[model samples]
Target: MTDTSIEPSADAPAQLSTLDRFLPVWIGAAMLIGIVLGKAIPDLDETLDAIKIDTVSLPIAIGLLAMMYPVLAKVKYTRIGESLDRRSLVMSLVLNWLIGPALMFALAWILLPDLPEYRTGLIIVGLARCIAMVLIWNDLACGSRELAAVLVAINSLFQIVAYSILGYFYLELLPEWLGLDSDGIDVTMWEIAKSVLIFLGIPLLAGFLTRTIGERAKGVEWYEERFLPRIGPVALYGLLFTIVILFALQGEQITEQPWDVARIAVPLLIYFALMWFGSYFAGLKMGFPYERNTSIAFTAAGNNFELAIAVSIGVFGVTSGQALAGVVGPLIEVPVLVALVYVSLWAKRRYYDTDGVRPRS
Candidate 1:
């Protein structure tokens, strides 16, 4: 449960790994392929179209399941008890649920009010917090994995409930506070809940169950060492493919309304910068080690786009402007975070004297 070896490497490049390096490229390729397929083979579109149930989108579900399997496999549930830090847990909860969403709402309102379409997108981004990609960011930043795991669970729980309730209040009730009219927009709590449950709950449960069973049968060490690392890349690829498909489905919208992308991008960029520095300074003030501080910073900075996308689509319909905002998040998020990883490493060397907690080999 404790990290005692592998100090931070001072000489490593501020760049993505072999797998990470190519992931965005692959994602782009998948999106192009999906668009071509959607356009060329209308039957394929029909087949993809037919694979839906009620509010749940099947292709997204499958992609999420694939994405989560690797993440779940890395989770050491046994360490949950041993690794539990009450202070860290409380800090993460307060930040994600109370401060994170509140700040996001404030920023979105301040930055995105002029454009209603982008404003809805900002709301979706605010509602959906970091769950999955935070882990990758934490790892890159040399943050505490144990704390990341705990935060992921906490945020996921909050997202299911808060995303619905908060989203409703934000879109419906809070408009008056911000001096905006709410007569035309229809926001439903039921729709939000249903989408979170379908997209998040099912895949989360499946991934957890699969991991639990695998661990019980083969043991944790074996599951982590033998199975997870191998399948991790596959899951990542699946997620990218799913993203491409979603984008392709909305390609016409993106192509036609190109200005909308830049509109959402502005607030999202501001939010990311604010959260990154906010958490970083907060961690430094708290006197946490560099690694733990980096972990906290990135965990707070990242957004759970999968959950955001699903909730947006469910709440605003797949073709709505809000869903388009959700889609744009990942496109901006990936490259920025990869750059931040290197920045973190640079900061660690420049600021802290590394006598403890060496970087991983």
Candidate 2:
């Protein structure tokens, strides 16, 4: 496979169609629609929540699968090994595991000191890491496709082992060590692992198979130019669909408790800015090219809202404040990450050379 991982072909914003360029608007509209639908229809949440695939709602699982498949299919899987950089991988691991969770823990405590449930929910969000939408954000920012694939793969496998342990530490032990009050959280490792396998594993396998079969039947050019574009729009549709469903399920809570949602959103905004900018600059300091650096930034910044919400609802009741906090995760993340995609493009122009390397000042 040819290595086009060094530089983005064109500035992302310029290359995007009108629909994609106005992604934030579309997302906002979806959120509003979901909220209206949820509020207007009695028992909408209960109805949506009726069907379940393990711990997650079946509609959500379907949306997640749809949201993930096209993006993963766009990855050039064959080149992931060839383009792998140990340094980038190490940085991603540290950001996702150590710095990311600790930052959320601190922010939650600092910002929402009086609200323990919300704090715990934010901490859970941090531990979950990004498996789903990072691919979309990374692709939108014109980041390295193969590197995003590799990092996401690493995160999925690592979360299966680390989520429960980290949950215990963050929720129970860390607070105790700090002489603070916290309730012990019971998180099943198998449930979390099952979620990862379903949400990520199924789509990943499908994406890989699609590419393998598609490429074998048709040439790479035909697949990349023709088939990929035809399917590309599905990703946006899936994303919009997921957002609508998520907001619909939690709409009453969000609209009713606007102030609380704002409170939850503040620390989340801080977390995304800190993670994305911090990771980007760290990669720049390490002399990484823009493509790899973007992958690092987005992968670090995004969290697995699906896993966090599932864990929260399973641990706390569906209407618990903790669950509301978990729902707020994507509500804040969507618009923010969409903005960062543009910001990444801006940084690319101002900071990076044509070859995607930031010149040494």
lDDT digits (tens) for residues 208-261 of candidate 1: 686789888998777666766566576667667676676666666666677877
Question: lDDT at 216 for candidate 2?
Answer: 95
TM-score for each model: 0.81, 0.96
In model 1, the runs with Cα more than 4 Å from the true position are 1-8, 11-17, 27-50, 183-224, 355-361
Looking at candidate 2, the ten consecutive residues that score lowest on lDDT are 1-10
Q: Which candidate leads the pack in lDDT?
A: 2
- Give one digit per residue, the lDDT tens place, for model 2 in 1-361: 1112223644546667777878899999999999998888888987888789656789888888888898888888888996678899899999999999999999999999999989988998999999999999988888888899999989999999999999899888999999998866788779888999999999999999999999999989888888888887788888889888888888898889999999999999999999999999988888998889999999999999999988888898777888899989999999999999989988887787876766445
Error of 1 at 267 (Å): 0.7
Clashing pairs in model 1, backbone N/Cα/C closer than 3 A: 6-358, 7-358, 7-359, 8-358, 8-359
- What ranges in model 2 sit over 4 Å off? 1-11, 358-360
Global local distance difference test of model 2: 0.88
- Each model's total of backbone clashes: 5, 0
